[model samples]
Target: MNTVTPVRFDNVNVGDALPALDLPPLSRLTLALYCGASGDHNPIHVDLDFAKEAGMPDVFAHGMLSMAWLGRALTDWVPQSALRDFNVRFAAITHVGESIRCTGTVTEKFEHDGERLVRVSLATTNEAGVQKLLGEAVLSLP
Candidate 1:
């Protein structure tokens, strides 16, 4: 059963936290598949030898892959139509076999131009609590 806890605009408040999204531990196959799907084809993400040649200890997950995870978490919480703007910056490299958790906190809620709006601060962190992605998103509510 797919259970979705609906987020209603009227009940939202500043500082409200969104339900978190947990992803399975990342893997080499996952990174390779993501590379194929995203057309990134960056050797640094999928080729261990290339990554080592680049001075990295191992191949790393693409920043956008983690960003996509964060976006999926947000849209899963509320309807995608409610999303007005979303942006993120990569904070640290996410490597294979790391667990990622996507989380968000409502930062502001207000009415603008007769539209209900909420701003959320978002983050993706690994098992060690190292932040891999820092981001913000704006939602327009009905």
Candidate 2:
């Protein structure tokens, strides 16, 4: 398993950019595996016929899948134990064959209840730069 170096509160500054994660293009197999692992089994994400019948051009990636990518990006930068709160809003659909890029920036840093904390703004965008997810995370750092 890959290990992440925990980010220290004192080392982070507002407006600092976290390392970006560029994921490979979303494939049909990836969608299928995600469906199985997530227990979503949503045909709209795996069945092209179902998606077409539903008026969509083709099967697309699940919203949670994209959000999960952003979460991975966050955890890749800091230890998972540092996360205190995480939330996201789905802004657009991610179509099959599209690559995603996850990025984050430290937005604020403060101390609360004797704990040092930082707020991070997160986003995921397609290769065309269309945003698919937007969110924030709060981390209690050592």
Candidate 3:
């Protein structure tokens, strides 16, 4: 396996692309694992049959899992950077087994109160380039 290293950015700037990340399909087991880790036990996430009966084709991936990739991309690129803020709104449901590509670009950078911060505009897309329009994230880095 190739070793992953953090990219050292001297003074954050605009137009920088965060490293790309690929996530596997969503599954009942995956949701269970996420629930164990995050302490979110919303039945809609793990109960597949219930989900199907509720009009969803299958158990959907956790919104956080999709957004977690975005956070990982940032930390992967800036290993030492501290994340000050992160947020994402679920725009669409991502079914299991879909390939999600996490990506981001630096939208702005500036110093606030003596702390350097970089604002990144983040998004995720599927192999076919469908984002599910799932969500957008802004990460503040120091």
Candidate 4:
């Protein structure tokens, strides 16, 4: 099994970027599964006809699913307990069959309430490098 070396607070510094992670390519089945699991069965995410009627070329992925993938990338890098806050804004729609890459750069670091914390600028991009999500996160480190 692959093991992750925990990131130590002392070893991390402002401007240190976490390695980029690429999620599996999004497919129609993936969208359908997300709709089922999240209970966000919005037709826009699973119905091509509904989406086209809504002026979109085809059904697209839910923004929350991309956000969840971003969260997955973060938690994979550091233990979930290290996450203090994470928020994102949907920048663009992610279409099916597109691969997404999640990346983050540490923007700042400080000690608060005896805890060493870091702020990171996070983003997800499509294979063509189009930004899909934009946001920031705060993490508590050990």
Candidate 5:
């Protein structure tokens, strides 16, 4: 498991960056467990043979699994009280043996129609520092 950020915020606004998250190398068992827990049965994520057949050298973690890590980071920073929208884009595949790091920086905070929205820039990368995915989130503040 990764350590959650200790940074706390009240009435967080745009242009604020959440603390970065770093985790140890991903374990095969962890990937298996995630597959079961998330109900994602893609063979490419579990069986290396199937992965090779699918043009990959070995099995990799699900894209959504990585996204879940990103979500965890966000939820930790914002808690459940002020968040109303969360979304991400999958940009590349992550193999089971690699470690992943999550990060995000707030980019915008504004209001329209009596609603307040905070836009954030986010991303994930491998241990080698290669960005595997990129995305953004619109957080509705309470």
Candidate 6:
């Protein structure tokens, strides 16, 4: 498991970039495991035949899986206790065999409820540079 390093609020800047996380290429086994673990047995994600029947060429990765990767990217930089808000919007389908990369940049910094906070804009893109997900996160820093 990756561990987060504590980030001090005063040390961060609005434009500082978070370390990028590159996930391995998605595979059929990964889709199946994620389906089982997440209880999202939607055939479009794990059954190629069902996907084809539904007009898709093949099964695709789950949207939440990509979101989880983005979350991992954030938590890998700062502890989960620092997170105050997180959300994502799926932008494109993530097909099997595609490698996903998660990235973020600090967009804002301020004090909320007497606590220092930072807002980050986040994204996940495929190896081809096509966006798969877009999101934002707010974290309380030490």
- Model 6, residue 62: what's the lDDT? 92
How well does each candidate superpose onto the true structure, as a TM-score?
A: 0.93, 0.95, 0.80, 0.94, 0.84, 0.95
Off by over 4 Å in 6: 1-5
Clashes of each: 0, 0, 1, 0, 0, 0
TM-score of candidate 6 to 2 decimals = 0.95
Candidate 6 residue-wise lDDT at 115: 92
Q: Distance from true position, residue 98, model 1, in Å?
A: 0.7
C-alpha lDDT score of every prediction, in listed order: 0.90, 0.90, 0.70, 0.90, 0.78, 0.92
lDDT of 3 by residue, 1-142 (tens): 2226433336556897766887776556778898789888877788877887888877887788777777777667665336766766677777777888888888777677666677777778878887654333444443
- How well does model 5 score by local distance difference test? 0.78
> Model 2, stretches more than 4 Å misplaced?
1-5
- What is the C-alpha lDDT profile of model 1 across 4-88, one tens digit per residue? 6567788888889888999999999999899999999989998889999999999999999999998888888888878889999
Per-residue CA lDDT of candidate 6, range 1-142, in tens?
4444468898999999999999998999999999999999999998888999999999999999999899889988888889999989999999889999999999999998999999999999999899989999999998
**Model 4, residue 31: C-alpha shift (Å):** 0.3
Better of 2 and 5 by TM-score: 2
Better of 5 and 6 by lDDT: 6
- How big is the positional error of residue 13 in model 3, measured in Å on the Cα after superposition? 3.2
User: How far in Å is the alpha carbon of 38 misplaced in model 3?
Assistant: 1.9
* Model 5: per-residue Cα lDDT at residue 122: 88
Summarize candidate 4's per-residue lDDT along 9-125 as a digit string, tens digits: 788877888878898789999999999999998999999899989999999999999999888878877888889899999999999989999999989988899989989999999
lDDT tens readout by residue for model 2, 45-70: 99999999999999999999988888
lDDT of 5 by residue, 1-142 (tens): 2326433234575667787877678888888998899999888888888988889887887888888888887876765555666777787888767889999998887876777777788899998888877988776665
List candidate 1 stretches off by more than 4 Å: 1-5
Q: Against the true structure, whose lDDT is highest?
A: 6
- Would you list the rank order by lDDT, best first? 6, 2, 1, 4, 5, 3
